[model samples]
Target: MPKISPKLAICIVYVAAMMMDGLDATIVGPALLAIGGALGVSPAATNMVEVSFLVSFALVIPAAGWLADRFGTRRVFLGALAVFTLASGLCGAATTAGGLVAARVLQGLAGGMLAPVGMAMLFRSFPPEERLGVSRFLMLPTTLAPALGPILGGFLTDHLSWRWVFWINLPLGLATVLFGLLALPEHVEEDAGRFDLRGFALATPGLGLLMFALGEGAARGWGDPLVLGAGLLGACLLALLIPAELRSPAPMLDLRLLADAPFRSAALVAVLASGGLLGMLYVFPLMYQDALGATALDAGLTVFPESLGLMLATAAIGWSFPRLGARRVMALGLLGAAAAFVLMSRVAPGTSPWAVRALLLAVGFFLGHAVLAVQTVVFDTIADEAMGRASSLLSVLRQIGGAAGVAASAAVLAASGGAGLGAYQAALLASVAFLGGALLFALQIRPAPAPQLRAEAEPSV
Candidate 1:
């Protein structure tokens, strides 16, 4: 029997964590109505459940690097999973919306560490030469979670209860934690600097408030004082955070990494590209259920095939990047994603199931390819010592981008008039616009010198 390589084993643990995180993020969309009914809250009120989680999640992410360095990656990771598991239990047991929201806050705090720390561990384990293969391991959870979330949520809600959605995380979280304890090797940094309290003070609320403002704007009018005020305040704080971190000797996050051209371009591209993908994820489920009159399970299944395409596209990147070059490969992906969005915009209520599936599948494939391409660039340029900081920044950017996407789509859908083919079309057009922006950024990526590619291109495991 072939032995499991340690790199693969560590990746498996990260996949498990990512899958759990992804499921929780998307599952709430499907289970929202049921949760509202159970807690005797209005639909608008229940949105706070997701908002609470996102806010807390964004707030704690900046601290992930500090915690991982000060403690140990393994210890921080396992502790996070434990806290997340316990919070999931609390979320499941809650009888009120307020209780559930509070529990979600705790879950988010724990979750903030999972992706960044886990990713740092992966980078630390795999040498730069082998890092291209890392995308495949990531694809499993990254593709599966959003793919499985709605289907699982719908089934559990239809057959069991919405509470089971939160309950479901308990077993997976616990098992992954247990496995991590045995499998993960400790790699504590010797001189992890002092935690930057002032930077933390600025960043945490700054990000949280920004995320909160986006979430609020999705539900409340953008002009509402609270939304406007939160947006202004958050922006001001983040504006302040930059200089504070750059000047600080012990910054909570390593803002200096942005100085690297490759990392900066890749990060910006990720933020732009993710907006389109997240918009589609939010819009498609609603379009199927509301526009096409499909049932929850049916709508979910309609979207499931996209994951297959995503996995295929991610797998192809390992082979393609060496020959095509990252710039060209990513350019093709962005163009293809833009085309998919255009096709999706033309979809109507009466569009055939097969046609819709084909469009979404194309979307998933293009986006998967595009995202992985940028991610490869990010790791390629980021230094070994700053891996943890880079990972956390990437994760934070992704969450912020997703929230922005959902908000933009929601706003367009509302403004264009709700729950109809026109609204869906308008929302999809917004996605196309976002992808077009990403394509421009993709075009800006200069070709890496030949030596760089040859040095990084090791055989996939």
Candidate 2:
């Protein structure tokens, strides 16, 4: 048998790790009630299981680049994967709410580091011109994992046990970690610089608090003192962080990367598009379950076709990217996504589920084009040394965008007075507006040059 290429091995490791990470993040939602009952706590209290993970995840992300630069990408990625797998086991074994929450925090810390560092490694493995290939690999984990999460969780909870949700990661995570240790290449920047204590001091609490506020504000209402206080303080700290990091000789985030036009345009478009897409995802399930009175499993199934559309679009991107260029592809993609949302906004109580499924599939297909375009072009000009920092910054922005999107959807639902079909429609239209805003930014992106293929020596594992 031919020895596996180092790049292929890395891709396999990265995809498996990311799929597990994404799956873990979303899979617990359907099990929350079961977990609460098993642990002798109210379902509301079990929310901390997710909150702990998200908060710790947000807190750790700003430091991921520094860790990767200081400790080499391969070491950091493998270490994080190991810790995540262990935490998954702990989560599965927990008998108390506190134990589960503690384990989740550990899981979040590991996951926060895992994703961006892994992304930096993957991008470094491939040249800029060949990133469309990377994007194709990317679509599987990013699209399928989240789409399948709720369905899998519901099934496992009903047929086996909620513990299986966390336990399921064990084999996948362990296999990926072992493969990664054997195959992943080491990369460390010599001038990684001293730890940015000041930036970390500011960013950790700032992002953590902001994430908490955004998450809780939707459930507890924006006027709640805790939410208001956290939001205000978090905003203030982040405001201060900008100037401090900008002046530091070695910034943690390397905000200066945004100065590149392609990077800036693509990042902005990505954040806006992420907000719309995630918002739609969050709202649609609620709409199906509440407004249409569908079962949880049925609701998840209805949305599953979107993942199929995403997969199909990702497969077609190589053909489209060469012909349309990044600018036209992204612009037309966003426009098409917005049209899908417009149709969704017309959905009512009596609307056919098939129609909703078709609209969602359309949304995923068009949005996939825009998303892959961003991924392909965002780092086209970033140097190899700065890849870690650039990936960290983009990750931070996408996190904020996703949280803010969910919060905005919740706010619109509240304003419309309830979770009725009309309220859900209004919230979806808000997503369309976000897509419209993204289209404007997509238009500003300069067309990427045609890719030139070149053969380079592959490093042996």
Q: Candidate 2: count the clashes.
A: 0
Q: Report lDDT (CA) for all predictions.
A: 0.76, 0.77
- Which ten contiguous residues of candidate 2 have the minimum total lDDT? 452-461
Per-candidate TM-score against the hidden true structure: 0.82, 0.78
**Candidate 2 residue-wise lDDT, 27-76, digit = tens:** 77656656866897643234456666766776688788778989899999
Predicted structure with the largest lDDT when compared to the true one:
2
Q: Write the per-residue lDDT of candidate 1 for residues 139-226, one digit (tens) a residue.
A: 6556567668878877887788888889999998889888887777888999887888988888777876776676666557679899
As a whole number from 0 to 100, the lDDT of residue 401 in candidate 1 is 69
Candidate 2 collision pairs: none
Which ranges of candidate 2 are over 4 A from the true structure? 1-16, 25-59, 68-75, 86-105, 116-147, 157-163, 174-192, 380-388, 447-461
In model 1, what are the clashing residue pairs, if there are any?
none
